[model samples]
Target chain A: MKRRLLLVSNSTLHGGGYLDHCQQHISSFFGKNVKRVLFVPYALHDRDGYTKTARDKFKSLGYDVDGIHEVADPVEAVRKAEGIFIGGGNTFRLLKSLYDNNVVTEIRKRVMEDGVPYMGSSAGTNVATISISTTNDMPIVFPPTFSAIGLIPFNINPHYLDSDPNSRHMGETREQRITQYHEEPNTPCVLGLREGSMLLVEGKKATLLGTTKARLFTSGKPSVEYDPGSDLSFLLTDPMRS
Target chain B: MKRRLLLVSNSTLHGGGYLDHCQQHISSFFGKNVKRVLFVPYALHDRDGYTKTARDKFKSLGYDVDGIHEVADPVEAVRKAEGIFIGGGNTFRLLKSLYDNNVVTEIRKRVMEDGVPYMGSSAGTNVATISISTTNDMPIVFPPTFSAIGLIPFNINPHYLDSDPNSRHMGETREQRITQYHEEPNTPCVLGLREGSMLLVEGKKATLLGTTKARLFTSGKPSVEYDPGSDLSFLLTDPMRS
Candidate 1:
């Protein structure tokens, strides 16, 4: 079976409701067969509130949302999940919870072997990548590792922002941070997914699906930009493995 | 011996030269006795370039700078150092090098026990605190632990920026990130040091230094602002230990 994923940059766009910008994409990605979504709300502090918001948004798209926290056995829930949706929050907290719940391997197995559909927004999209090294969120907690589910070979920097020319702040810009990521040995390519953008993957094919352009940074290479509908299947194959 | 530390928010101001905004503070903090300063340039990728910057800046202040990387033994370098300065770059890389070079404990001993004056800017200030959970830098690399030098009881969020009311970005504001850090169990208070601001510590007393005001966020407590002269010695005591 082919692995399917819809990795969203953010759950909400500026001046938009929750998942409003990507509602259509979500609907088509899950399709009619996936009746329920296993929502991982561990990234956030308030699981109930986050789950409710996700539930409402998924319900509007004709799908029921079941928060992974609500289940008696999280591993069993992931195994039985028709589809998986992870929302955005603190990346460290999300990855730590995924480890604490011992669901990282199970989720990977379900998505890779069982062909369960996987959907992630913001922090969710971060964990879907090979690692969360490119996330914009603060490291409020230390996870057991920086590794993630590896649904995609490359890392996604969700909500990637451009440097404001007028800003006087001396902190490293978003681009600078991603460039620094490449300084490490054996680092993977980083996709800077701008707000209102996402990547849709079916089998070995991946496409940029949104209104804005995404930036790609690879080691020893100049960063490039990609527009909506651009082919990104090349990112699916791990360069290290190849 | 008194634990002396100068934690700066950033190395440069909006329109100033490197360490230009806080030169006087650096001079007075080091005093006339500390003639040679050991500089830790591990936070940045270009060790030589970063060391040159630090050497020039400290020279202007009537002190000689020695890059820790230049020495054969980093731990020995830390032990014999008259003064220590860690410049800012990526926090993850900085902490990882500190552990990899086996200098975290040595630097801690040099400053906390031997009364060696410790100065850190940006990522440097981050490592002086309890943890790097509140840092704004990306996790380009994973360190063995999030634990840092416990020179201060609380954490410092250097280069802290206020949320722009006019901006459309949906990312978490600096305040929100620090608040999220408090959500973690046994977390320490966080001091958000804006650009051109720093924290100066001597013995049990810590004072807010530099031009701008600093914001303090304690768990379950309302956030408060502190001016340049405000007494922040209370933060020297670890509530977890008490």
Candidate 2:
């Protein structure tokens, strides 16, 4: 079986203190009896505050909650870990730190080459792309333009939500960003993911796990709506073989 | 002096009417006695509606607007052409027509190889990249994945406006998009253009026009603000020497 890669999002999470979509699904990839969990608190406003709770959750799950730090030795942590879970926070901040520490290269090697069951929340998932050009963050921090370990070819625009009528600051909507991507190059297939939706890439199969329709955008093609949990082998590689 | 390249924008234009930016600037490029003008109306909303008006504009300048449907035929039109202008509308629509008709190759050859004096508004300006993945429109219309002619390497986010307090939509701002670009695969600078602002590329010099400052995003570097019209020869190759 292919190692599981999971992304948990803060964008869609309601209230506080509960896992959104794909939270429990992490167990499916790493067996129910998985041990040794490393939770990254880089995104937390109160990194220390979240660390205690994360440690408790892992202890309840019968795994060790190794350590919680604003900055950790990513290479050493991954090297000694069984399963890695990166929780949600500001993507720009998390990625900037990772790039700064030179842990990005090691993390890619761990997941793509070593088959580590890698799981991330909002920003964690955003980093799984060739580049994080699609994230909804201000370029307050700059990191290198390295491709994510060849786990995926295209970029991911995560935590996608349509425009809410009740809100007030005017700017480009999530739909508009995808449109901008389409207007500029329109080649890479941009998956506009809803809150409950999760994209599962196992081996060559890319399975969408969610309850609603996810939109796919490609260059020169009309934007199409797709039901989640459907196998998208046709979109990637050879569909006929799948 | 190197041949002039002009870009006209449709975004941020209030209730588009007669040409304000195009006419005066374009007239200056070729001089008062303009002899040859080729208008690419692929970006206009109503192709037929704007095509006639564009032709009239050229005729008013005492220059003939060559070929309508043959706008894609760059080889024939670009030869000995004194001026090339692309009108504004939906860049996606314009690019779709360009890609479907397979005119990108001929145009790239004319601009990159033949060094024709090129002028484009909105969509026409957007097509000068390797891909149109950074445009500011809905992906409703399909253009080629890499529709840009790659006259420049970085992505162009045109008609960029800061968030207006009155309207409410949640997403990354243009500054955030450049930030995200800097965060990952730190390559190709992101140029966030406002209305009336244009990028002028002549031979080896790429200068930001109109705007006083441009935000420069690079990997591992803090995004710095640079004055517009600064000599950007570093970003370009010396075409004369090459």
Q: What are the iRMS values of all candidates?
A: 0.8, 8.3
What fraction of correct interface contacts does each candidate retain? 0.76, 0.07
Interface RMSD, Å, model 2: 8.3
DockQ for every model comes to: 0.83, 0.07
Q: Ignoring the other chain, what TM-score does chain B have in each prediction?
A: 0.97, 0.79
**Candidate 2 lDDT tens digits, B94-207:** 777677766677676677676777777666777775456556544334443544777776666566555555532334455655554444443565565666667677766677
DockQ of 2: 0.07
Which lDDT tens digits does candidate 2 get at residues A103-217? Answer: 6777677776677777765666777755555665543333444234335666566667777675432334676566555555423666666666677776566787755567766
> Number of the top candidate by DockQ?
1
Candidate 1 lDDT, A110-212, residue by residue in tens: 9988899999999999999999999998998889999999988889899999999999999999999998998888888999999989999998999999999
Total clashing residue pairs per candidate?
0, 22
| RMSD vs true structure, all candidates | 1.5, 9.0
Q: Give the runs in model 1 whose Cα sits over 4 Å from its true position.
A: A238-242, B238-242
lDDT: worst 10-residue window of model 1 chain A: A233-242
Candidate 1 clashing pairs? none
lDDT of 1: 0.92
